[model samples]
Target: MYEFCPHCGLKYEVEPGYFYGAMFVSYAISGGVALVLGFILFYLAGDPGGWVYVAVIAPAMVLIAPVNFRFSRVLWLHYVAGIKYQPEL
Candidate 1:
């Protein structure tokens, strides 16, 4: 599975453990985006109850779960694949 690069089409083998980093990256991106959105809502609403923040942001985060999964896989492929393509003359 870790045998292809998505960006450049380069083929090289990589250890399975290498993908763990991509998972971290994906979680960080998703969580950070959700947190920021939560903060924005809090500010706009004059810092309402804590539940307000959770209620609004939790759904947004759930909505993004699928997208995050897909993004993580693509990122992993890019890192592992290390494959590059060249244009034909």
Candidate 2:
């Protein structure tokens, strides 16, 4: 990731290791996706076999990992680090 926001020139990391907390945010995002997908598999798909669940969920998770990783870090910056949005910037 860039050390600063290209548009506004704001520093990306407040301090060293700041993004370590984003790991928890990423975990939460993964858990939420798993829970929702599990429900869909259980109810809509009529309780597919364990292997089916693994096959479908694993790929979906992998597909969303990039988005989830970026979002999680942004979330950590906005909420945990109290970085406020400044549209004027």
Candidate 3:
């Protein structure tokens, strides 16, 4: 993670432990993914065995982790930290 934005020199971490909230955001994202996947598996796939879910959803979560991590922090920064986008800046 960057300590500061390269383009604008704004600190990524606005305060001590500011990113801690991002963890919850990430978890929520993960849970939402899992819930949607589970719903699909249950309805579309006829609720395959438990191991099928483990095999599928586990890797899916892992695969999305990088995107989830970044997006969650960005959301936390914009939505929670009230950092507005300034394209002119």
Q: Pick the candidate with the highest lDDT.
A: 3
The models' CA-based lDDT, in order, is 0.73, 0.93, 0.95
Ranking by lDDT: 3, 2, 1
Q: Tens-digit lDDT track for model 2 on 28-54?
A: 999899889999999999999999999
Off by over 4 Å in 3: none
* TM-score, cand. 3: 0.95
Worst 10 residues of 3 by lDDT: 80-89
How many backbone clashes does every candidate have?
5, 0, 0
Global Cα lDDT for candidate 1: 0.73
For candidate 1, the 10 contiguous residues with the lowest summed lDDT are 80-89
Q: List, residue by residue over 1-89, the lDDT tens digit for candidate 3.
A: 98999888999998899999999999999999999999999999999999999998999999999999999999999999899988987
Ordering by TM-score: 3, 2, 1
The sequence of per-residue lDDT tens digits that candidate 1 reaches over residues 1-89 is 43655655555435647567778878888889887987798778888888988888888889988888778767766765653445661
Candidates 1 and 3 compared: the better one by TM-score is 3
Per-candidate RMSD, Å? 4.0, 1.1, 0.8
- The TM-scores, one per candidate, come to 0.66, 0.93, 0.95
Model 2 misplacement above 4 A? none
